[model samples]
Target: MEGARGSESGKDPQHTSLDPFQVKDPNKLAINFAYMLEEVGKVAGTWARAREDAEPDAPVSGPISDLLNTFLQVSEYWRADQTRAIEAQTRLVSTFLDIWTNSIKQLGGEDEENPVRFEPARGDKRFNDPDWERHPFFRFLKQVYLATAQWAEEMVEQPDNVDEELRQKARFYVRLVMDAVSPSNFLLTNPVVVRETLASNGENLVRGMRMLAEDLAAGRGQLRLRQTDATRFTVGKNIAATRGKVVARNDLAEIIQYEPLTPTVYKRPLLIVPPWINKFYVLDLSPERSFVRWALEHGHTVFVVSWVNPNESHAEHGWEDYASKGIDFALKTVEECTGERKANVVGYCIGGTLLTASLAAMAQEGDDRVASATFMASQVDFKYSGDLKHFATEQQIAALESAMQARGYLDGLTMANVFNMLRSRDLIWPYVVNNYMRGKEPMPFDLLYWNSDSTRMTPANHVYYLRTFYLNNDLAEGRATLRGKRLSLADIKLPVYLISAAEDHISPARSVFEGARLFGGPVEFVMGGSGHIAGIINPPHANKYEFRTGGVTGGETFEQWRATANVTPGSWWPHWQSWLAAQDEERVAARTLDPHKTYLGDAPGTYVLARD
Candidate 1:
């Protein structure tokens, strides 16, 4: 890496030693702080006088008053926070002075360990250059930034008075501040960007500007880090190239029936319910990594729901629409094609949520079409739905609804941005620095491409989902209704296999465990080692990660279950296969699709290809 750093020299005549001090100079930062403080003081005085004039004799009791009081309290908290920050800065300055004094006394031979060792966080490659630590000024700046970030994190802890909604927002804002102040975001401070600029004779910067302009134009002024060139992968060609036929199609979904690879198949057919937020091909990305292929090879007839990339015409489609017109229809189609009354079902992410709801609804109506249920990284209980809850607040939902109303659907780009922010260090900023700052093209990664190729949600569908599942959490509470009939997870008495990603941020493991407990039947909960996507798509051949499994009773907590759970190495697919086979009837000759219902088309159907 050190040798590579020197290779860029003499590439550009205009290149010079980049001054780290030029970026985020303490004196300049202090001046900016002073200006902000003065402005805040003025605003505070105006607010005080206005409050005095408007509510001279009124008791602060109304909603407006409550909001005002909350604001004042938050302001006070911020003021105290600022004081602490200043004291910390003072201490840092004092330490720097001592270090400078020692350096002079020993003629720069002071060999005591540097008070601040700049260690980048996991996955943060910006400060990987040895040059960053070798320079005293850069090292000092890194320490200051890290210390400030730590202080900000500590300060952002919500007080008892702060509501959950406000607390989440506060934490989000604090994170934004931290991200904004990261030394790598700037041109001068980031060694990689500086080196790239010099190596490319400033061409990288020009190319970056052009890319920025193009993105702005394409995304309607929203800054989207292009993770992959959209043209690199095409559905049914190089991506979701799995062989299958579209057995059924509706306004909401295209149900694909995969051809079996084995001579014999399980008596019960398998149906996959994938989240509509993304294309169904995540399970069928390519032959090597395709879970669909794995299942088919294991002697099980597989079916996948390819949800339509909804448009303005589908704006009125809500959760009910997804339940009735989506999975319900898929279930009926599967039964019709296979001549089987009962089928095994697997749901991933939001698709799992919808499947759970459908099962509950089916149970309520005394419809016993489902033989067994498998939920993959899906949360039925929203109590601990993870960071996504931050965007489910009333105000946030309303704002989102307004945006959707104008667009007729929640734009895929907008949804992508929200998910990216949850892991911005890995998803957003890295791409920003690589593509925009260094003008490097994004690598052709199948998973990242799938992540980028998102689908839009109808306005009504999105709003209803956030409010019903995320906000009110009506489904878990048995308050959610479908087609004038109330549904309860307790009503669904079928055996269930729940798989949750151990490191999932979208659906926390504990939340998934809670969902598993809701089933009033034998539940086998498995914890996979990776995150939401990687965890579910884990194939047995790779033998990449491990999984934990144990009988989960309704009484024990997630931690308690984990304490004595059986830890098994390698993919959970084999375990799932065993459980699924046990739930299934005896193997029979592979069945073909019904001749009555004509085959629509090949797998990775048109619906998956339809982009918003």
Candidate 2:
């Protein structure tokens, strides 16, 4: 409301007229439809050529045939969607007429007591203005829009046998249509914007246009929908500022050891394996929320793996390279530094997945150096990887592979966009309104800053990850391999502690539950409160959310476990610390660093600051 503005001509801003023709042009849509038809024709031509070149009796069931079939199927689905859109528009017209009729009846005093009413869907704050319901015409228009949106959602159907990727694509396109036509998105229909336009006398519109242009330049023409400025936060100075020193460095990762806080420490050390997709500092965001600091204060020796931001030279690095040369190397360094045989290992997200594979490989080779394993929001079983599976289809993966082949790595911006879309309402749309429509600057926040500091994935490693774990789902099926040796999760009989976020969209809680069952040993699975990042970073003092923990014996479903698990308030970190304490031997004098083995410079290390 504050940022909105109308024209310089002193027109009634609340009823400011907008060019109906300028609302939306269908020319781009027509062009896209024509292009799709042309592409389909090309595919058909290629198929015909292939058929003619083949032997008379030979079946035409190869790559070209598959391509043609996919194109045809997509076109069919598009046509179905077009029909649904038409049906929704017809419903809109009928609803409009009904509203008109109802208004007349009310005007004639036939239905004065039961007058026409329009309310937005519960939790939809877009049309909460009392003025919309006060006027019958506004109410009718709002209802028509809402009804059309609902009809669009209901009518767009996917066949049972259609490719999941195609279905997902169709659903996404449908949502795009719905968002585009929402009254809240338009200048004329948005009450708050209209009111603000009247108050500001067109200045806000000029400011909004300038903001939009700046975002276009800064975000490379993509909508800059983030709430935080990417350049405001520095790694070591503010974020990931936990005190520590790098003790060892390898081709893949840097091992950092935090200085001890207490007079004595547990005999076994704790090593953290953070996801390589982003910088490791998510675990050590700031002094107030740093899990690394918490672990140190609790009298445990802490070590973390900081993976290098890879490039063309490291493009050939694979899972084996990460597992063998990354985690394996970190574990050996922890042992050498602490003078201990085993270390309690902790992995978050993809790092946890890699840790699981590495642990299984180690168990297969009869190495028992791992004291225990903890997987936080990580999934070894990809069967239920949630909406992200939409991008793992063979065709999608092949397209991604081509992109990576040309660049030597998957661009961080590409990966960030995919994750952001998973929670667009929370992460994308609000910022569109705030930064673009409202003409406001982004606010500073530590978590969002960390989110913006993303890292690239080397081509070889990323492709193998998508193919083996996501596309094939080979890890859980006992078919995945590491360094030419087949890897299986069941082989690892080590004690396990698994944490799953109740609202995590990335590694869904149910999938994490299934992953817990894959371990062939005692497992303590805990359901943490909130989504992927916030759930894990919640500190004990915050007293914000709740967690549930129980013994998981691999025989019950996630729902079953939830039904019987003990619900505990506060962070899960204390429970984990208690569990770690139980697994410890006699406490000893705090260990000192082995100065001779130390390398690299400091706490966060150079890898985190490396850019493409």
lDDT of 2 by residue, 466-524 (tens): 99988898999999887667887878898899999999989999999988878888888
**Residue 363, candidate 2: alpha-carbon lDDT:** 85
How does each model score on lDDT? 0.77, 0.75
Model 1, position 341, has a per-residue lDDT of 88
| Candidate 1: residue 444 lDDT (0-100) | 82
Which tens-of-lDDT digit does each residue in 1-612 have in candidate 1? 011112145332222234432443456546544554454454455545545553111121332343444455555655667775576567657656664554343223344544433355786676777556555445555656776666555555634556675665566656755786788888777777766665555556666655665565455545556887767887788888878889889899999998788999999999999999878889988688989999989999999999999988898899889988888899899998888989999999999998988888888788999999999999999998887886676766776677677767777877888799777867888777877678778888788889988788898888988999999999999899887878788888999999998889899898998888788888889999889999888998898889999888768878999888899999999999999998855989987655565678878788888875
Clashing pairs in 2: 5-197
